[model samples]
Target: MSQQDRIPCFLLAAGRGERMRPLTDDLPKPLLKIQNKSLLEWHLGALRKAGIQDVVINHAWLGEKIEHALGNGSQFGLHIQYSPEGTALETAGGIAKALPLLKPEDYFMVINGDVFSPNLPINNILAKVAIFRAASNKPLAHLLMVPNPVQHPEGDFFLEDSQISALNLGAGEKLTFSGIGLYHKDLFKDLAIGVPAKLAPLLIAAMEQNKVSGEKYVGPWHDVGTPQRLQELNAAYE
Candidate 1:
């Protein structure tokens, strides 16, 4: 496929952002402002800059606000579509429900609504997907990792030879999930439609098969999980 044809779109603005409480009590986490713009706006702006034209955003809590904020996406010069969930479906469920909106491509990208990261290279993600598809017999899902934050330093997974795995908890090195990833729909091929589920077990299943790939992002990344961290992030950027 041509490079342009190889570009995959994304899933955005879906999570409950529970950790970002109080602030999220009145507004969805994606609407939280930083430098006078909502976090979702920041992501949309970046996606626009990266030449991505199609996007899928799912929402539950205060979802209409999202539609109000980004109607039709023409304002952003993109074709944005909404997959409204009356109740927040956890990550996997949301993705499973939104699959029809995605193209029948090799893989698609997913980004957490609450994460803050420096501009990522979309081409880099496409490259990873291609490499994994060519190399392994297993299905491909490339996750991005970041260094553990002080608040939860134990972190989520360990990386060995471009793969992600659960820690031994006794002799494990810690690295945090960056909340950005490339996923092929085949990862959910066997999932029953409209069912609610989390991505943890699915991810662990992929890891067990050695199908998961990862890269450490040493660039700027913030969890922005609470009012305090939101304030801290806002102050840092100021």
Candidate 2:
């Protein structure tokens, strides 16, 4: 398949960034800067380099600023569309609602707005998810994992033999979610569109069927959620 035919994607930027507090009280997390550029811009530029042409960004808090800033994505050489959220719909539900904007590919990509990870391997991640989808009758989602970073030392999920298991259950070491993943649309078929939903439950559900795949990334990455972490990230680039 051609690059465009492989799959299209959406950037998950609609969160209110409640944890970041006063910093995000006025600006959305995706609009915050590191090395003089917004997190969204870095991801867009990276996605463009990986040959993705179309992008859909959903936003709520201070969302207009995102539109005003990235306007149509021409600056980054990608076609852009917006799904303005009157109220944030969390992660899975946000993707569910934006289904119409996505192409009829086997799967699509999602990256959390508050993160700054190394250039992602979008094609490889999709390849792995396709392998899962072929073996299971149900939908599949492939998550990228990174070694537990400082802020979330407890970590979030666990991996064994390329399959991911949720941390809420039995004994297993936790690995950070890495804010990067690929999801087949069928994963959200049972969800009500435009409703609030987190990706955790769905991830666990996929884990039960042994349908979720993951890879641990030992590269440059950071969850730039707070002002302190953002400052550290900026300093490293300088």
lDDT of 2 by residue, 5-113 (tens): 6567789898888778888998888998988899998899888877778889999999999999999989899989998889889888888888888764667888888
Candidate 2 runs further than 4 Å off? 1-4, 127-139, 167-173
Using alpha carbons, what is the TM-score of model 2?
A: 0.90
Looking at model 2, which ten-residue stretch has the lowest summed lDDT? Answer: 130-139
**Global lDDT of each model?**
0.79, 0.82
Q: Which of the numbered candidates is closest to the native, going by highest lDDT? A: 2
Residue 138 miss distance in model 1 (angstroms): 4.9
Cα deviation of 156, candidate 2, in Å: 1.6
Residue pairs in collision within model 1: none
